[model samples]
Target: MQIYKNLLLKNQTQSFIDDKKHEKIVVSNIQSRKNPEDKEDFSKLALANYLDEDTGFNPLGITAYKMNYFLPFAYSFGSLGNDNRKMEMKFQLSIKKRLFENLFGLNEKYYIGYTQTSWWQNYKHSSPFRETNYQPEFFVDFPLENHSFFNNLRLGILHESNGKGDENLESRSWNRIYASTAIFYERFLFVPRIWYRIPEKRKDDDNPDIRHYLGNFDLNLGYLGKDYFANIMLRNNLNLRRNKGAIQVDIGYDIFNNGIYWYLQYFNGYGESLIDYNRKLQRLSTGFLISY
Candidate 1:
């Protein structure tokens, strides 16, 4: 009888140990599920690894140069009865290289990047390039997965200019010191940015009153999901009486778990391009977007 009692106690002890192990496994699984939703630590992840990462430098420059067709087909209106009113196309090409990682004891990465966006009047007789905006930027990314709402911070200087002839009366250009922040809320991401135009010589100021139209700040909202994504941008002049602003909406569906997506974009407002900074436009376009 004593032997039987000892055997029963041993069995009970083993059963208790197995139950504790199972509970620990369940807890670990819960944490794994929450990590992706909560921990957006960009410092460790290469730029190409993070899904729905904001527009910025890829630290490793894994994809050194990339060209994406932003809007291959679109009908634009509100040209104010201009001759070039018709179907148009737009595309962008960008390149990035890492300058330094963990710069000077600070946990940050420095990068140099150049991006060019072109608007094409494909239906025109000469197939003229309506406008091409060239942007060169030097920036630093500080990755912090802090307890606060802000997840990342970036500081940058950018020069944007339309490579247009000085003879063109509608010439536009600007230089700015910009700051961007990435905020995460479960599955939603918001990047609110602000910029101050670097003062140019009075003689070189192409658009002196641009602030009245383009404003000093903009907001970007994004949703990073499993199979689909959506992003929206808002900018305004903050003048309540003369309220002027712009809105851009982009939606995409992941194709076959690859980085390529079926993308649709829509814009309604002013400042779609440097040359058209003052022209109010309503454009709807569809194309493919490839993002790493």
Candidate 2:
């Protein structure tokens, strides 16, 4: 939720105009006399279509997944007070798709998404993987036009686990139901989200009091700069007596006018990863991202 708001297709939906009509609109200020059909034609056939159109085997409703990749090289100075573990590497790959549109005769869209993040101890002898977090979620997005600031709302059910069972007693996992809405103001975007964790059986509960560290709600703020993007994520439990939370920052700049960009990130929190869910961590990293 760190403002990964599809930058590659930022202007993908721009209205199109014929050569003659375009000249008149630009010169005569007759913008209201544009062709609606031509606009739709250009929108659907634009370069962004190649990246988002449903082209693969769609045995079911319209389904298309877009790749979101982030690969980073990191170094942690305060490694939770551990030695020989300061230098590390990390990567995250995410994919999401629209499964169906206009569900149950309602103008709502259903989507499925998955994200995987791996933490590697690349400086070690074996270069072992410290931990990997896997998250899969299903959500419904509803478009809104009533308010000028609010544009979209979403509700989702999420499952996140480290995939480590009895092997690691400290393995982390959780199930949540969340609601989110996006507010847009010019080039600024803000999203606020709240979630409720589902109770699990005592025997299977890995981190029962995770809400204290991971928090129950999150807020994201984003800004689209001239040639770069910046986002900040904030989380808090909203407990007056025992306040706890996390913060993450990300900045990315397009490189070579391409889809790929140079990315930089910093995180200071209690739940940075599945394995380190209960430990405090401060890390900084730089990498490349291919996002849309």
Candidate 3:
């Protein structure tokens, strides 16, 4: 009887140890899924955590959503307008905040993002801002696993406007819901997105024909290098009869290997700005960029 009791106690102890081991394994797997083994992914996680530590914002940390840059000299190929000068300054500010992580146990995260781009005619009298575009969006990001080239998928709703008021003739605004994906191959990354504009009443609609220039789809291809990087953005209306499109290229070199980069950008096409969505533009700009 004594021997039997001792054996039963030992078996119970062994069973508890085995259960703990299994629990640890499960936790490790989940953590691995949350943090991927890519350079960009790791940097993003690090930036978020660092921001949280500095601002004491808990889990909500703000990070860069798009490229942040300031160009002092952007020269246009031809005349812009009577009031506008051929050479002007341009800048962009973009940011994002994470709202939730893994809400549905699917390794998905939610974020809110805002981006603003401005074209400033500093050389002109009074140095007025020619045009400014504002974009705000809410998105959910899903990390993919074991895919040959696909790395991430995102679904989002976006609103963009020039903020000139709905009643004003200079008003330009639109709302869209979009789907996009991130594909990675070697040192290159490709992001393609398709969007459907939300319909509005004819009376309330601003820039009704904006889609003919801005298009329903766009592609961003980038090359990530150790000391340099380059990106290309392409957009088209996809109309066979009256096709219209735009292309932008950006090249940057790491300055001092810090987060600052010397940047050069060239844009050729329509829809570069909301106020001039229908006008074609060709510009070359050089400036500095801040990256994480």
Candidate 4:
């Protein structure tokens, strides 16, 4: 009788442990279903890793360089010319790869980045692409330590162009050398950048006065929250009499508590695209952002 009682007690304890384990597994699965990317920080994860861990050294790890989003319904508020439509689709793809890290023992990292943005007139009659801007850049990032205000600095040279021939008078392109810094305070981020446009030949210049519209400096301010984020970009040419620039606002919400966000963007002013560098307009767009 004593042996039977002991055996029964042990069995009950084992059963209780099993039940707890099963409950934990079920809860984990439910949480995973709710937020699939919770275990991995999807927003910061590199989009591609060509080398495996066993390789020990990865020289070609590619990551998202800027906001990668697809805006299916971007509607302009004002006039957009006779042939262009008011509503269209827009998308951007940006990526970067680290070339060297701390090569000079200064903790400076070098990288190459490429970004492409396209404005598609999908709602138009023949669904022609309005404009596509391609930007390729090389930069060095220096991380600061014990800095009270600024945390990082970057210096880069960038070239952006609309893939258009000069024959039709539709060519637009620019080259710039820029310096930017990053400041962080709690959940807020501030980035200020200044750039100098490289000179082009008289015959090659498509937009000579582009600097007046796009400005020499720009400010980016962002607020990050647990389930939402917002960013405001401001640019000013700083002309005393004929001040001109642009403003863009972007807000994103994680409605399902997932990594993917529903994004809204508002832009007013010039330089929305290479072709529209000198044209001022207002646009409101809704989209989805996989990485920010």
RMSD of each: 11.6, 13.4, 10.9, 7.7
lDDT of 1 by residue, 173-236 (tens): 8999999877777667788889999998888889987887899999988776665777899999
Ten contiguous residues with the weakest lDDT in model 3: 45-54
**Which has the better TM-score: candidate 1, or candidate 4?**
4
| Winner of 2 and 4 under TM-score | 4
Q: Which regions of candidate 4 are displaced past 4 Å?
A: 1-60
Model 3 local distance difference test score: 0.84
lDDT of 4 by residue, 137-179 (tens): 9999887777977777899999999989978788999999999
Clashes of each: 0, 1, 0, 0
Q: Local error of candidate 3 at 24, Å?
A: 36
For model 4 the local lDDT of residue 99 reads: 84
Candidate 1, position 227, lDDT: 56
- lDDT string for model 3 (224-243, tens) is 77557889999999999999
Candidates ranked by lDDT: 3, 4, 1, 2
Pairs clashing within candidate 4: none
Best by TM-score: 4
Model 3 error, position 160 (Å)? 0.4
Each model's TM-score?
0.76, 0.76, 0.79, 0.82
lDDT of each: 0.76, 0.72, 0.84, 0.83
lDDT of 2 by residue, 29-108 (tens): 43432433222222222223222454545565333232244555787757644344777888888767777788667578
